[model samples]
Structure formats: C-alpha cells, structure tokens
Target: MTETPSTMQMVSFAAWRDGALHSGRQADRRYVTLAELLVRLGSFGLGLSWKARLFDRQPHPAFAQMVKASAGSGIPTLELLATDAPYRQAVDGDFEGYAGSELALTLREFDSSCWEVRTADAWVLSEIQRHYPDARPMTSDEWDTTT
Candidate 1:
C-alpha cells in the first residue's frame, strides 16, 4: 500500500564540505525521499534474478532539469534525519526478493572525489558523525522549511 503523506517519513539533512557546513541552497530542491530520489535518478539493471531489480530504469524528466540547475559547490557529507519507520518497497512473485530496509542512499561526485550520505538510521548518522566531526544536525525549523 502507498503511504499517506502524514504516514510517510520526511527526511532532511545538512551537508558539509571543505571542513564547514556548506550552504545548502539547493537542498530544498535536491533532497527527497529515497523512493522519489530513486525514481528521479533511475538505475541500471543488474543481471540478478530478484524482482526488485530496476532493469535499466529510465530517470524522470525532472532529473535532467535538476542536473542543469545543480551548479554549485559539492557537499561531501550529508546526514539525514527521519523520526518515523523506514520506507520499504514491497515486491511480488515467488522469488520474493530481498526484504530489507533501505537504510541509506549516497550520491557521489562525478570525479569520485566526494559523496553525500542520506539516511534515516540513527546508527548510520552516528557513524557519519564519527568520521566528520564538523557535521551538524539540521534544526527542526530547517527541516520544517526544507521538507
């Protein structure tokens, strides 16, 4: 079943780059739920037998627009927050696929020099903090405004 807006968990995050909190000017537009993000970005198919495979999925049209608009400093680290249960995509058929929560999503720079992490799991967030001590949590007001 599709989750209602109220039941769906909203994720928001603050990004850090060059040892400082990067101005997340584009965050409001870039950040979205893992499901929506995946849909927007699309994926290549793996030869796996699972039903969950994307199978050379094509990205939404807005993805190109987003890329065109994304001209700014890159943030290497991003810590996401979500208070509700994690989002899951259910699949059908005999294989059943692997049933696991999508705990995190990462977007890497084109040069592979940097990456951004998005997660709802506290443990993952803590791990991010351990590595990037300068990373800061987003204020409720910021989350309220951005999401």
Candidate 2:
C-alpha cells in the first residue's frame, strides 16, 4: 500500500520540541504515514515487527523517522529510549541530547506526521537527502517546497 503525502496530517514539530528548549529552525515539509514510509523505504517488515512489538500502539508514521534520526545523531539507542518515551506518561522530563558529537542534526516531522532527522546544516542535507530518502534533512524552504 503506497500512500501519498497528501493523504495524512501530521503533528507539528513544535508540538514535540517546544518551550525555551527549542532551538534551530524547523523545516516545512509534508510527512508520509508510517505505512507509506515503510513502503517508501522497503522497511515494512521492520515497521510491522516494531508495530507488533509495540502492540500496534502509536501506529503513526513519525516514529520510524524518530528512530532513524535519533540513531543517526547518535543521541541514544531506542532500547535506551524505551526506558523513557512520551507515551502513557508525562514524558519523564526533557531529553537533552549529548553534545560534543558536533551533531547539529535533529528530527523534525511534517504536517502529515511523516519525518526525517537530518542536520540543520544545509550543505550536509543536500548531499545526503538523496541517498536516504526518509532521513533526508533540508532547509525550511526546501522542505516546504515540493520537488
């Protein structure tokens, strides 16, 4: 089932990253649903497995992108994240990512709730977005404008 970006609506990136803590401008792009993203990247099997593991819990597509970004930024492993995710709770406080990795990269979801976490660094995104379709980072305008 290949879904288009026009079909679904996503939560705002600001909603997830808010308050004085929020830094760096977020890009404006539409996100694909979890199913669409899985099919987009041929990661359906993994998505399904994760869905099953989570008992089909928040089946939104954004999660896949979250996992991808977190790992790429070397923030922390999902296994560690599982210890404290924003589900069924007030989200055990903020997650200040480890610095010194020099990773200006972060994750951002689209209005469709589909997302990718790539560097806020424009030069890097232009080079990498093509290779990793789902995880491509882009400038705000580039993200907003449909190619």
lDDT (CA) per prediction: 0.28, 0.32
Model 2: lDDT equals 0.32
TM-score of every candidate relative to the true structure: 0.27, 0.26
Candidate 1 per-residue lDDT, tens place, 14-53, comes to 3323433458644332322333322332221011111111
Which residue runs of candidate 2 sit more than 4 Å off their true CA positions?
1-79, 84-98, 120-137, 142-147
lDDT of 2 by residue, 1-147 (tens): 232334222212222312233358565443232333223333211222221112133533444344444544333333333432323222111122233443233233333233443333344344334434344324555544521
lDDT measured at residue 113 in model 1 versus the true structure, 0 to 100: 21
TM value for model 1 = 0.27
Worst 10 residues of 2 by lDDT: 44-53
Enumerate residue pairs that collide in model 2. 10-111, 10-112, 10-113, 34-61
Instruction: Score candidate 2 by TM-score against the native.
Output: 0.26
Q: After superposition, how far is residue 116 of candidate 2 from its true place, in Å?
A: 3.5
Please state every model's RMSD to the true fold in angstroms: 15.6, 16.4
